[model samples]
Target: MSDAPEDLDAWVVTLADTLGLGADEHPIGLLLDLTRDAAHGVTRPAGPLTTYLVGLAVAQGMTVEDAAARTRATIAEWKTEPSEPA
Candidate 1:
């Protein structure tokens, strides 16, 4: 259940089509960047969770760019905390 396809691009296209969304319409680059940052700054699991929450925000009217910026900002700040950070 946790495995990734050898070809991520193909998998994205397949999933998007299955969900009736255009794969090209999504800001895949931005999302990937956010995922990478969250995984590194927070935790491995946070990467997908962060994207899932972002997806919710998008579904609820927030633009993907704004959501990503907000999440990235959170990751940056969270990494800079004086206390033990994730």
Candidate 2:
């Protein structure tokens, strides 16, 4: 996380480089867009978990773009139950 929230983009770049993910090659925008979709479609806490799963999908031979596309489709069809009786 950034010390100054305004520098989040810079922080992400630095963090990616430090982690050896390479800022130039990292799909930051795509991942962030998918995370945003998950957070809104499921719950705020679902964002990170969804992204983590996406990474796992990448490890299992799926391309990030394909995983993200599939995830977004699933999100579009998701029907979440309320936290409590409505």
Candidate 3:
């Protein structure tokens, strides 16, 4: 296995191909930004949970791009709202 960290995209593509999933159709940068927004604007666990919801939406026949767009919009709205102190 290659030890280069820059090869993460290649590794992700390979894993997606192995699983017969369509990762190449989506923009990695956008996904990362959405995840970052979810984590920071909402909560740490929200990042993965948001992504998981996007996946579920896609599985239910929504386009991946649309799901990402919706998730980002939701995060934007979350950022505008005030959060209660933990």
Candidate 4:
């Protein structure tokens, strides 16, 4: 119920069970890292969006680990590229 770090594991498990998702299919640490990377390297909004896309990719048969890896790679590439003016 609380957004505390200590509550994350239980929250993830409960949410996963509620959505009929398997924990094995969604690694929390990897997803969190990807979110952080996307948010910092790309855009703040990209954090949740990237995570959502990763979930969609997994739902479409991609492994979570692979999705995370691909997402991280893309974020890395984005970081290397110059940003366009707002």
Candidate 5:
């Protein structure tokens, strides 16, 4: 229900801080912004596109190990290259 973009941004920043990810510069800040968008219902249809998914999951009360595993699975799905059956 927190769809306001500004609120999303703030939430993301605070999350980054809580995780010690520190959204004060490039890369990390951008990723945090992306996570905020996800929480606000924005999504990349193909799948999770960044570590933001991991961070956001952690922020959502998921256990660290569970979030890490889910994040890894999402990343693997995104990175899987199409293969031709030999």
Candidate 6:
């Protein structure tokens, strides 16, 4: 089944707020950037809104594997060094 629109919208909003940016910005992208830029692995209290987004995604017919894969891709993007323009 396709993912629920409500769940996706809410997730984006919460993520945007957490990053102090507009919802138009990609939260997953920001998260990956933050994690990659951090000197050490960091863990902070997950905003209640973020927790809700995760649960919402699961309920919206997203498999854990699907969610995990997206997360991994975002992280991998961050791990790669940005190429400088020649």
TM-scores across all candidates?
Answer: 0.77, 0.70, 0.72, 0.80, 0.35, 0.32
- Clashes counted in candidate 2 amount to 0
lDDT of 1: 0.84
Write one digit per residue (lDDT tens) for candidate 3, span 1-86.
78564586788788788889866654667667778889998989999888878878988999878998888877787789855657
Quick one: ranking by TM-score, best first? Answer: 4, 1, 3, 2, 5, 6
Model 2, 1-86: lDDT tens digits are 45664486787788878888775666778988989999999889999999999999997999998999999888887745434434
In angstroms, how far off is 56's CA in candidate 1?
A: 0.6
Better candidate by lDDT, 5 or 6: 5
| Candidate 4 Cα outliers beyond 4 Å, as residue runs | 1-4, 22-25, 82-86
Candidate 5 lDDT over 1-86, as tens digits, reads 77786787787688769979777633444455445444333345423444545656666898656765565454445446533447
Segments of candidate 3 deviating more than 4 angstroms: 1-6, 82-86
lDDT of each: 0.84, 0.84, 0.79, 0.86, 0.55, 0.51
The local distance difference test score of model 4 is 0.86
Q: After superposition, how far is residue 76 of candidate 1 from its true place, in Å?
A: 1.0
Best candidate per lDDT, number?
4
The digit string of per-residue lDDT tens for model 1 on 1-86 reads: 43454476677788999998876666767888889999999888999899999999998999998999899888988888734635
Model 2: residues with Cα > 4 Å off, grouped in runs: 1-10, 20-24, 80-86
RMSD of 6: 13.4
Error of 1 at 61 (Å): 0.6
RMSD to native for every prediction? 4.3, 5.0, 3.9, 3.2, 9.5, 13.4
Ten-residue region with minimum lDDT total, candidate 1: 1-10
Local lDDT at 36 for model 5: 47
* 17-61: candidate 4 lDDT, tens digit per residue: 998876644477888888899999998999999999998998899
Steric clashes per prediction = 0, 0, 0, 0, 0, 0
Better of 5 and 6 by TM-score: 5
